[model samples]
Target: MSDQPPRDSHVYDGPVGGWGSAKGIAAVARTARPGPGAFDTLRRQNKPGGMMCSSCAWAKPPNPHIVEFCENGAKATLWDLTSARCGPDFFASHSVSELSGWSEYDLELAGRLTHPLRYDAETDRYVAVDWDTAFAAIGQELQALDPKMVAFYASGKAGLEASFLYALYARAYGHVNLPDSSNMCHETTSVALKTVIGTPVGTCVFEDFDHCDMILHVGQNPGTNSPRMLHPLQQAANRGCCIVAINPLREKGLLEFANPQSPWQMTLGAPTEIADRYLQVRAGGDIAALTGIAKQVLALDRTQGGVLDHAFLDAHAHGLQDWMDWVDACDWAELEQVSGLTRDAMEAIGAIYARAKAVIGVYGMGLTQHVHGSDAVGALVNLLLLRGNIGRKGAGISPVRGHSNVQGQRTVGITEKPELVPNDALRDLFGIAPPMDEGWNTTAFVQALLDGKAQGFVGLGGNLARAVPDTDRVAAAWGRMPLTVHVATRLNRTHLMPGRSSWILPCLVRAEVDMQDGVNQQVTVEDSFSHIHGSIGKRSPASPHLMSETAIVARLAAATLPASAKMPWDHWARDYARIRALIEVVYPDDFHDFEARMNQPGGFYRGNPARNRDWQTDSGKAQFTRPAALDATGLGVGPGLYRLITLRSNDQFNTTVYGLSDRLRGIEGDRMLIMMSPDDMAAEGLVAERRIALTGAADDGIGRRVAGLRVIPYDLPRGCIAGYFPELNPLSPLSRCDLASDTPATKGIPVRLDLT
Candidate 1:
């Protein structure tokens, strides 16, 4: 009878630390009598309120640290502490037209939606309404749109008092289409580093990686996406510096990273060897591998002529001879077939920038997911201004940004426009006159929701219909928005791309607790090394009917403004330190002492005067231009066309999904694949893992096909392919992007493929 007691002895009883030790010993050899919820699902896998330590949003904290998370912040803290809940009688039994036909992880695992919701579109569903009738039906649908038909997006995990009261309720609703998630990642390094070194971000810090000797990790990875930048690239690669990388996918956490917060290197399992020089390149061929490493650093300054700083290019700079005549008119075999890299790996990355005397580089969105992504970030700041590597200590140019207040939600004002001087000291500090002009970004709010001229769609925490690309043309231009709202903390696929009335609202959760009015607030983020800290939560609000994205942007700007609007939105929503004293009367030279430097504790210091060389540009120096050499066959190619690109995984970030798995190109559960280059998969006879499909040549050309995918074949190069972004954002076509930063070149999609 004891031998008969073997049905599934609590299947795979424990330990799964590194990629599930052979699937936890093959679930203990197919369960010997398992079922009792298999030891309560292996004692609830990531247990202790899963979502790994020091409050995640993919942790950083590090200053006098006590371990801050990472590993995609422990898979975004087990996908936001999922034990799920979408209460209020599951939206009174489903209806925003059948829960907008479910699936954004089944309306965020059906949980934590305790209250506020509205979309009763003829009772087609979504009702729980109560935060004052869902902030007066989003202030009666922003008082029936036409404030330039409304758009207000802003999601870099909304903080700093809900993006300064959602840019003071969109300049009290005049307009400024305020699209967010920095127009889908590093708005081409914030429009080419604020038009060449006036600064949009990254003048480097964290003790400038201890005075970098060489870094260059172009087209970034930071081990499974910013694993606390693997303990400063393992303390500058155990003090030997020179990293390099330039990815196309060799990324195994940049080839070996162990530092789980290094305690003498995590008890000697000590990994971090991070790329001393990898360089696979290819996808959108990072501007012909950054102009073939600036033509081998201008042929090593013509055979090492004092390694050229030429006195910081004759004091600061400007168009160095039309960037040396577009790198001596390109064509080194089409820069080795668009950067599969090789003139001895472009002279060993120009001999580590001519024996580095403090280098840095960095970069992400694989060089700004691009169609000349701002001329490949101005040719990596024209190879860091051909050696002056911007203003000093540990060279410059970083770009790795991915949320954590996406560059502090474009520094306090979730832009789209409204900074062309709305100032009258921010209209006597928010009394009125904020709307200045321009707006609608994210390619003009997806072309004003595809030219219906945007109706309404607020967001304030992204997933903008799966971080946009083409995705059924941005979910059919967000279903012709007649109101879409969202605010969120959970539930995504851009909250079911609905509209014609839809809400969701929930909020809170940057590792929880927010409170507001009665106090316990905190917020404020901005990191990809621009610093500005103070995050303050410590778990709690997965419920209690979550809210605090600064109390839903001050009760949706006091239920959509009009007591003839003029700020004082309930005294700056009951004080976020008077919304940093009106963001110090609108960015007083980088937020003067915004509430005494956010009451100290890693939060103040906007100072980035082009990291010292000053140049707030329009010339006080650091201005450099000349970029044309463009022509990637100006989108007209054949011989089985090509290009593609997309990317982002190591369990994704922009467009959430913490794990559908991608453990560095060994992919796993599946993100469809594609990759390419074994000579373009044996010149399309195709092989490695096969499958394929692609298509899209533009406009009803097989209406942007896609099909199976798979194909794999590693080290990409021959005319490119890649994949990943919102699953190959249907091979990217919204009339491509980056004609000087309109952005959407989600890393170059032109396509053709086949062999499915």
Candidate 2:
């Protein structure tokens, strides 16, 4: 063997959530040094009247563990509660041009923003400004521009109370361009679920895992994205529930798991195996694999009388015959080729599903961030419907949401679609004639900026500049905006890209106390399971100048809108309960008894009507959807061209990079490496650690390219490559997106790699 550095391709054989997880948490603690108080905050996470984890949106169990927090949750908490501070002095020391050169990790790791800041073009640096001055300037700018020229972008981190106020403020200003994080990640799920089951949210709860006999996990890496999910997968595995992992990579988390909280398992070095069979489906081939499995089930139903749920189908489902005919028309050879799997494997998975009485289908961005993501999600729902897996205990579709409260933001009227908003109710309650036209989603917002149509931007929270596709172009467009106001806790890439008149308003994080009108305040967040719970911070605010998200929105609304009886901005700012009361008034069905139930342990469940067999669709029944095509990517595959899939490291959450090391993937100190199959490397005459350049094959004439990405040969299918996101986000053009959901095809972009 050649004497060279190890090619960042070591396989991680250890079980998920063992000592490795413990080490990851410890590392974050060391880096953050959140002090002894952080331990108390960690202990209170996901508990009754406790703060929700700032990481993933996994539901908390009714009987919570003493250590309910996971490794990722601990990292996020520590990160939020870090002792480091980014005050006026820090900004005074560094210019925007200089700070723009820093890495994303360094920008966030520098510390929390302590004071509100306004960009001073004369000095090319940010200067401290009082809240009143900043708000007045922003309000004046908003007054000058048309409502349609401004876009209000909400991050998933904002709580329901804050999000409601933000949406209210946008509408009160006569604008509805409320683009949020959901527009990028789970918008496909929302669209597909609504079309099929008449609901936008998932139908399953945390307890469903306990009763599920089989779980079909597709396109999601629970280990890295949502580590808390491992507990349920472990329990289901221990009880002999057959789990079939359907994804391109054989993720270590789905293979086995050792609960770090369990002393017995950790001490014994024993881990419960997770997936009984791992199907390595090709990137963007989810529809084909789903169709292949459904075809096998249909064949089995034809030969065996008890295979299909005829009773459930006849009463609750529509368009079954058309869907079955479409599935029948799908050629097995074509499916095998597109899915990169054998027919026998699909048959095996179908057999397991046929034998199991209850099955749950779990998926993530891997299915949604595709060219045909809506179709792929519809296909998965169709597969689950064949066996009557929906609307029953232990069986339903679970889309693993990335950010906490992302779903809640949409539920509380933070959507761009006019139909989803309670326009009449808002008009009657708030005495404001909110815009009825559909506004900009994320993609449209970016396009508006690129086209110079957008004049102002108000971000509730998020690194919009780095998270979206066409990073360089988006940043350029963002910089050209007449005004930009960001409400955030820390310094992010989006904050650095100052517009002509930009402001960064410091806000309190989830782990910090929010005292309003001399009383402690609690905000509510809805989890992936549609359970709404209250989160009250235990620790003091990171900075004295930091304002609560609700307060920021309230004050901004007060500054922007004229004095009106219906819009009680000051009252809402004084007490968050007032905002929750309005939320209850707006969404009485979901938020009924909002205060009483929100104080209860684990809060209350926002019941899914579909769960009770009450289909809210146009036809009054769940509909079976036909896949547009077998290939979900809709990208051309050819020699020297590879389909790219973006991934998140174990050390990273959505856009927050905690560290450079990815313990689960055995990657360290680097984020620019590309993961490719050994066979593909050989075919391309590329060796491990060979630097290469990838150019996107988008037909929009935009040259999307990134260079100097070292290749690491790994266990993946041919004609496929993987890289960490935000780094590879440049290769994803804005034009290459799902038309139905407008979600960037980040998971399946066609690219050509050449040796650099």
Clashes of each: 20, 0
Expressed as tens digits, the lDDT of each residue in 1-756 for candidate 2 is: 111223444578688898989999999888888879999999999998688898889997788988999989999999999999999899889999999999889998888889999999999899999999998988988899899989999989899999998998999898889999999999999998998999999999988999999999999999998989998899898899989898888788888798988898789767888988888899998999988999999999999868989999999999999888888888899999999889998998888888899999999998999889999999999999988999999999999998999999999999999899888999999999888889999999999998999999999999998899999888777889999999988899898889999999999998888998889899999999999989999899988899999999988889889999888898888988888899999999999999889967766898999988899998899999887777788876777778999999889988899999888876787798899988888888888888889998877889888998989877788898999989999889988887679999999988998675
TM-score of 1: 0.35
Q: Model 2 clash pairs?
A: none
lDDT of 1 by residue, 1-756 (tens): 001112211112211123332232233223223233323322222122221122222324335344444445444544554555777777677655566565443555554555667666576666776688778877887797787777878767666667867876787678777777767767878778878887777787667777888888877766556666666777788899978787665656666665544455445454555677787776666677777877887888888687878888898888788778867877778876666677778777887787788887888877776666777777778888888987788788777776666677677777775554345766675567666678788777787677778888887766776667677767767867888888776655666556877787776565565666566766566566665565555556667877777877778877787664456667766657777767766778877776656534444567788888887767667766655544322454468777776767555666665445554555555677777667666666766676767877765444777798777665555676777777678567666777766777766677777664
Off by over 4 Å in 2: 1-9
TM-score of 2: 0.98
Q: Distance (Å) between predicted and true CA of 105, model 2?
A: 0.8
Best by lDDT: 2
The local distance difference test score of model 1 is 0.66
Q: After superposition, how far is residue 712 of candidate 1 from its true place, in Å?
A: 20
What does the lDDT come to for candidate 2?
0.89
Best by TM-score: 2
